[model samples]
Target: MLLRAALAALRRVEPVIVLEQLGSTFFDTALQMVVRDRCANATDPGRSREDSQQKAMTDFFMTYNLILRLTPILPSLLLARLSDRGWRRAPVVSSLCGYLLSRLGLLLVVVFSLPLQLMLGAAALFGLSGGYSAFWSGVMTLVALRSSAGDRAKAMMRVELLYGLAGLVGSLVSGHLFQLYTASLGHGTILLIVGTLLNLLCLILAIVLLQVKHVSSEEPEEKSLLPPTSSNATAVEASVSTNLVNIVLLFVAAFLYDFAVGGAIGMLGPFTLKAPLSWSPTQVGYGNAAGCMIFLTSYIGVILFRRCISDEAMILIGMLSFASGIYLMAFATTTYIFYIARILNLFALIPLPTIRSLLSQQVQPSSCGTALTLLQLTLKFAGLAYIPAFTKLYQNTLDWFPGFIFLLSSIFTVLGMIPISILGWRSAGGKCHVRTQGGKQPRCHLEEVPAGTSQTGTET
Candidate 1:
């Protein structure tokens, strides 16, 4: 019941969250166009009034963009704490309330002044939507860890499938809406209406989730099957020498990988729109939808191969696939080639959840949230450091030396594959003993079951 309610609420709010994100992307594009027009006409002899208005709008959008980046980090920190405290449901409720109130406030502000409304509304939507990504990522990670090994891959696949479907539908619809109402209704106004409706639906879902009952700990059969070390005493010490080594290696690898990939993606859409391969907004949206489709299909394949192959092998395959995709993208000469490269790139990402799941199994459950959060923080920090530099390089050099920036990005991705290769080699050589399933005792190596032993199946 609790799960049903929670899912219902998620479904309700998800569309609004998606719409807001789409709107933010659209606003960024629109703001860029306005800025360009303003700069072009700044020298006009009789356009002083228009110049002033354009400058004001440009400043507003720039400020809004800055807030969009910063505001999400604060809420993410709060959500991290809530996750650590096991207040997952409470955070969901809070997010819903916050989104609704922000929307209502924006609506009133817009009523008083259209300009202020656009600025504030864009900022609020961006922050709310951006924060939702991390919030949902954390929630899904927890869910994956809590589930049985048999169900873990399937659950992750399901989440990916839903995310893809949302992206596909949302992007296509938003694009059509914008094209249809470009003259009649501003894109911002239409986005606001869509967002409001989605938030209301999400609120209803959140209310429903409050009534679902969690399983009782006192149930005799359940108690017998539960893992040992559920108490605070079992919290893994962060200072333990071996644990510290593993953690450091994991963190470094995550940082490098995310830094490269994040920087590349940060510039991807913008570069596509303004470069040798200038793609229209609809084309970009379609590309994104295609990537999601590829990701969803590859995710299913990952689940299917989970039992047939070792985790190390899977990771290696994913990395290789990713590296190949990056190289292909670096040399893409046409839209079709770009689409193919993106599909391959999506396939390469299939191992992310699997890798995270592996990391979770290495640590005690009590510290799972902290471990995951640390990894997330490291990746985000790396991305922040690298994105601007890469974006500048891509923007300045993409036209004259097409593919140069992409080539550099591809090199970074290849470098990231090194640590994963090392880890995979170590794992396949039987050195790492991280159990992929929940259990009372930490095993030193993979289990050796009788050839004929029957394995129990759990629901996905």
Candidate 2:
């Protein structure tokens, strides 16, 4: 029974998470080396090696960020719209193709010592296929379509848990993989090959095993996940106006929170390689592994706290935890202190997924693809702005203080808490439960309910 249950769960869950983790682990591990190689190759013969290398790295990153952000916006939007209109597998399969090609591009870069600028072309291809925006939106739609509102938070958390666990394993192994074949196949070719294979597997899985069903937003009364509640049923209903307001607020919060987190992740590798902590590749991999640990710990946190606290409260706590940890990271000059800061960020990933689950509850199932894709758009657009800004900031302060970038990240995280706080306060004050149901504005329920949990009591 346990084996069957596990198999059933795997069949229901999306495999994109594992594939993405494998590719990301390989890409991030190779990115720094690629930049360094490009810089070395570009330096004028007998020139100031340090200055030339630094400039090359900076230029490469700035250009990479710009292309990555700009190229995908339109394609991802188009792909997402088509998915919403019934072409569900297009985005998933196409994005996997992009990942495979991109990894292959990286492999060629390491194998033939191709120009670093070639990756920009690969990035363009990735964007053309819709990249992560379309892929994630599609995956989120799959998750939402498979579960009801009350179970969505759990479902999303489970996906995140799998994603993080895969990331942890990938990160832990990536350094060894890179090192093992560096002498035989150049620096990062082996890792890139592995990533490409992983992407291919995902593409195959999507083509063969994955099946997307269009679940109805309005379930039958007899089959409702929430049991009928005569007295408190109306309390959970929200007016359309109120729902609109809350959703807008949630998106704004998501934008701010992601800006901080994404900016930090984008710049951390180069920053660590320079100045106070000149970490080796192994150390870099370990640092990334530690970051992946956040997912596992955050998953555990959700399980432990969801029963006791509201999702809104959990999001608030997540934002604060990230802010504190990132703030401390700005002062971390040693390896030990850096790891300590990572430990402090155990709950950093909770807010985004929780916010997404909350947003899923506000929309009908048919709109999940559109809604989540728009959310992904907001985040990717935010990344477009933040990555360039953070890279520039890190470059300017590299000599005087490279850690300044982290300080700015910490500030944005603090700002992200505002909307969450407002929502939490409103919920605490008993103004959140009176919601809309079946075209009727019902009376507000006074009972405290978590953001995604049904106020009317759930099925056993």
Best by TM-score: 2
lDDT of each: 0.53, 0.77
List, residue by residue over 388-453, the lDDT tens digit for candidate 2.
788778767766777798899999998999998887765455434456689887866644243455
What's model 1's TM-score? Answer: 0.70
- Per-residue alpha-carbon lDDT of candidate 1 for residues 1-460, written as tens digits (9 for 90 to 100): 9997766665443433444344433333434333333344344344354433334433444454445555566566666566667765544555555556655555444334344535466456645643443445455545544455445555555655666666666555544443444554543445445656666665566556433222222212221122233443333242233334444555666666666666666555544544446666467657666755755776776777667765545656766666677677777777888887877776566556655655554555545555565566566567556755664565456445645656676677667667766655543443324554576676555321111111221112
Output the lDDT of residue 334, model 1: 78
Question: lDDT (0-100) at residue 255 of candidate 2?
Answer: 96
Name the 10 consecutive residues with the lowest summed lDDT in model 1: 449-458
After TM-score superposition, what is the CA distance of residue 101 in candidate 2 from its true location, in Å? Answer: 0.9
> Relative to the unseen true structure, what is the C-alpha lDDT of residue 143 in candidate 1, on a scale of 0 to 100?
56
- Quote each prediction's TM-score: 0.70, 0.87
lDDT of 2: 0.77
Q: Which ten-residue region of model 2 has the weakest summed lDDT?
A: 219-228
